[model samples]
Target: MLHATISGNVVTQSTTATNHSILAFLTSTIGQISPARIRVDNNTVINNSTSGSTRGILVDTPDTSTSPSFDATVTNNSVAIGDSINGVSGLVAQARKASETCTSLSGNTVTFPNGTPSGIQGLRARQADTAVYDLQTSVSCTGTAATVLSCLNPSATTEVLGTINTVSPGTCLLPVTP
Candidate 1:
């Protein structure tokens, strides 16, 4: 009778409650609660529907509990989250993805630690994605390079150009075709 427990959809509507550990309070060494593995996958646990004082899901010890009291392994379970209306538990997904989104509007430039342009373009050129650049895609600088990259080809008309210092960006311009 060691580490005894129960598991299921537990709905606790108890308004006046104390010294109650709903669902589980399993422990080993010195009367502590430790479940070998609490796989709460694809299940929802909503506790204390009557008031906010109670806990929806608590993997914790009682007031008189000692060290190494309550140790649990919970997975894939959404607990304690609730709606604004009744203050009761709600939803499997916590927050909105639309609120976190910022780059929808134009002129918005999200830079990484080293000032990288966001989105697919940013992930494509992380330098660590060398294999993807080499094997998956290649941008050939035509009209100048007879070989792989143009800058190495002295006779190549096309080149990936760089500017000298004091050059105000637009000053280092190249010719365009009609």
Candidate 2:
């Protein structure tokens, strides 16, 4: 059930065993609350299914100036369970591969698959600076090249890895009230 309206200090507890999805877009303009207390657990959110233009539990721009603090307590959810569905991406990509040459990425440095480089920082870093990335399968590899995650697993020898997933901020300006 979609929430009619979520106000300040919302305490939600849901136990849904069904396959349906819940999409709540938390935004900077959602509420007057700077940090909205949110607790989500035990939900199935497939990217292609839970997505319109974005993916699962997206924090977007319905409200850009609200500065809602999103405390996501997501746990125990099945995302990729397309047991009987085929080609479920809804929107068709022109090609199976998406690539773009980013000049800005040159000096950024890359983290190889899930393997951390020697003498580098560990995965347990601050949320503001640390990155959480996943490498999914893409059909852009040669015969020997598998997927980034496949290769990263070490068992899958010589998988073609995509660039370290990076998210440089797009140009967005949230209003600041004096």
- Of the candidates shown, which would achieve the greatest lDDT relative to the real structure? 2
| Leading candidate by TM-score | 1
Q: Relative to the unseen true structure, what is the Cα RMSD of model 1?
A: 24.8
Local error of candidate 1 at residue 131 (angstroms)? 47
TM-score of each: 0.30, 0.29
| Residue 15 C-alpha lDDT in model 1 | 43
Instruction: List the candidate 2 regions with Cα displacement exceeding 4 Å.
Output: 1-20, 28-32, 45-56, 59-62, 81-178
| Tens-digit lDDT track of model 1 for 1-178 | 2232234554434444432223433234543433232222233443334343343434322223222221122223333322122232121101011111000000111112222212212101011111111101113322321122222222212111121011121221121212
| Clash count of each predicted structure | 9, 6
lDDT of 2 by residue, 100-170 (tens): 11101010111223232233221110111121221222233112213322322332111122233322322
Scanning candidate 2 in windows of ten residues, the lowest lDDT window is 100-109
Of candidate 1, the 10-residue stretch with the lowest lDDT total is 97-106
